[model samples]
Target chain A: MSKVKKNVWWLVFSLLFLLVLTVAISDQYYLLVSFLFLIGTMVPLYSRFEKKKIQSREIVFLAVLGAIAAASRVLFFAIPSVQPMTFVVIVSGMVLGSEGGFMIGATGALVSNMFLGQGPWTPWQMFSWSMIGLIAGLLKDSALLKNMRSRLLFGFVMGFLFGWVINLWSVIAYIHPLSWLAFIQAYIASFYFDLAHALSNVFFLWLFSSSWIKVMRRFQKKYGLLD
Target chain B: MHTVLNDVHPITSFCYYIGVMILSMMFLHPVFLIGELFLFILYNICQHNGAKMKQMFKGAWFFIGVIVIVNPLLNHQGTHHLFYIGRNPITLEAIIYGGLLALSFCCLMFIFLSYNLVITSHKFLYLFSRISPQLALLTMITMRFVPLFIRRLTTIKAIQKTRGIQMDSGNIKTRARNGMHLVQILLVCSLEEALQTADSMEARGYGVKKRSSYLRYHMEKRDIFSLILGAIILGICIYGKLKGFGDLQIYPSLGSFGLKGIEDVMLLILTLLFTGYPLILEGREWLWWRWQK
Candidate 1:
């Protein structure tokens, strides 16, 4: 409990610091600020995982979900920007809770990139997917994510959010002067890809997430995994 | 795969790629970037043949094109205006900035391509394992499960198709539904088995003590030598960066393209050598092989 409190305090402090940092920094430093932002946000989650005494069962369970998510990515490789990875991650989160969900999401990104080829985008991909899982798990019991329709809505939003986060790298790296016009233009250029991703997430969640969640929940209960 | 960096220690190569990546981002100068890009492209050509390089270009040209074309249109901050579509002036500085950034990104992409070829999955895992043993173990398990799940998915797809649950032969929504259903079945079946694998692992005493790696990587004499050279080169580059020697100032006004002093020339040469670290090793190996014969 104290550890959780400490983490929350750290989070609040970092959020405040980041807000100030972004407002204070110059435009040319956008790339450096964004990187620092990524590292700052990611460190806490990974450190929490490191501090815990993880079990073999939990490790294997997360690995299996990650592998399944990555396999779906590879299977749907022919389709551009359309995969059920987010759907799988959402279901994993809904079943396994936030920590498990974050691991699976991150692991899924890492493993999939192994088969697909790693690039500068790998870290961004990991960050986006992991956030999706973390948010889903956090909201699993909330009224916002209770029903299938609302869950689908969440997935849809997350899909675009994921694309936008990935687009941040390019915008930061390439956009000169870093004006709002340039930022908006970059986002606008990638609009179609984000739309496709969002629609696919909605489709997968609407048609299949409930069943995936049910199966996962059953496994969790039967094996007492992640308890 | 007898690639150039194939035998180099993962630590050495990883540091080299990371150093070059950081330096490329910092050195916005055209001379620095063009020389760096040229060396990496040459290294990439050495790593793969002409046909593969063409395929890489095909994959990368879209992003490069977008950056080159979009920057000048949106950014009107520079002094020298090239032209204007309407109200927005296409300044020479924005165009030059865009081109340099595109070149930098293209170089990084080629470097990553070489990274993919050389580091491979196991080496990456090995590097991570040193930092966090548990995370490394989890990644290894995840890596192991990927191919297994892929095979299982293929089998499940075959069985599902036999039962008329075809994923590829339907409309978009229907196909997507069928696909998720297949994955759901996979999840249900695999979860139980994965737990059993966990149980077997427990039986074999997995979490008892420190886990050992299956494949060992050594930091050999050459790797050490390379590390020493890398440290010196990158130290100089970083020092040069702090002194604002390699970077060009483009905003407000354009900076001159010529070297300011002897320090600038030396820094430029060091930056190129640092970026060409992989090629240096490859060339040495090529010469050694030929000379021995």
Candidate 2:
């Protein structure tokens, strides 16, 4: 119970930290603030993960899946910003549950970027991937997610969301004194890439959704992991 | 593995990574960023021995080149009128800012490349284990899995080729579908093994007690020296930034990047030296090697 309480406070503290960060980003400390905001989001997840006495195999499982998620990018290396990472994340969430999804997605982005090159986009990628996983996990049993078409549609939408999430760094850190019009223009320019990412995701999920979900679900039950 | 970088302790390398990351973002001025970029290019070339540097350029040249051209087009705010492009007006400030952006990104990209070279997966995991053992272990798993999965994917593709389900041939749709089918087979085949993996964990003491990492890095004198240097420079940069010395205000009108006073010059020099530490060290090492020969 105390562990859970400690986790909850971590949530509150991170939120407060984020609030302070937003104010700082608007002021002269934008660079520092931007960094802290990234750390703030990640800390809570770490604290929560620590609270649970998770076993080694579960950790290994999450790591393997995360690695798979990172390697998934290599398959789509030919295409600009198109990959099945998002699809895999959704399946992990739907079958293995929320934390499982979050771990794989966040870890995937974090480690892959370690190889491809880490930048200002690191924090945003971590946050966005984990959030996508968390949302999928929360709605794992929902009828919307249970519906095949809706799940595929969700993956498609999330693909665009991932692109937008990356673009946020440019919005806050790069563009000085924030102009909405320029922000919109940046989005407009990257629309094609985002569209390709979204469409490719829809294709992946449409074809392999059942098998992927079955694999994840069967593993979850047989091993009694992340229940 | 150029000069002293490879031999530097992992902790020092990690500190260097952190310091470089923050400094690149904090110092928005072009002069500082350009110098930093130059150092990175030099350091990268030194580390990779010129061969991989060409590949890095091949991959990154397009985006870096685009930044210099695109930023001026997208952002048109400055007093110094450079020229007219079509109907839109271009300004020196926008161009300069664009150049700074490009240079800073170059510095960042190079920093990470060096980071990958310096801090291996074992080092990264070592650091992670101290902070949060669970996450560190997970990262270890991830690091291991990436190479394993890639190898497995290739083998699966090879086997599937024997069965006549083509992977590389045919149209994009057919090729993509074939790839997905191969991935599906891989996933299902691995599911049973995943259970065994979990079973093995249960047999071994997984969450039995508080986990820890295998302590590999022992802090030496050089490690401590690097740590002190890293902290000092990071502190100075942060202090200078907060005091408005390194601030490049460009919202309403562009601020002067020119060294107005000795203090400004000192601040600039401080930042330049910190960022250029690798460049200076590598230069000295190269000269030393030549002299010895």
lDDT of each: 0.84, 0.76
Report residue A84 deviation for candidate 2 (angstroms): 1.3
For the predicted complex of model 2, DockQ is 0.55
What does each candidate score in C-alpha RMSD? 1.8, 3.3
Q: What fraction of correct interface contacts does each candidate retain?
A: 0.90, 0.58
Instruction: Categorize the docking of model 2.
Output: medium
* Candidate 1 lDDT tens digits, B16-89: 88888888887878888889888877887787645766888898899899899988887788899888888888
| Predicted complexes: DockQ each | 0.85, 0.55
DockQ of 1: 0.85
Task: Summarize candidate 1's per-residue lDDT along A151-206 as a digit string, tens digits.
Answer: 77888889889988999999888877677887788779889989999999988888
Candidate 2 per-residue lDDT, tens place, B1-293, comes to 54576666777777777888888877788667776777788778778646666667788787676567667777777787788989788888887777777777777777877777777777777777767877877777787777777888899998999988877789988888888788777666655565578678778865676554466567888678767876887787788778878657665578777755666677777777777666766777789899999
What's model 2's lDDT at A189?
76
Model 1: docking quality category? high
lDDT of 2 by residue, A67-136 (tens): 7678887667767877878877877888777778888888988888776766557778888888888899
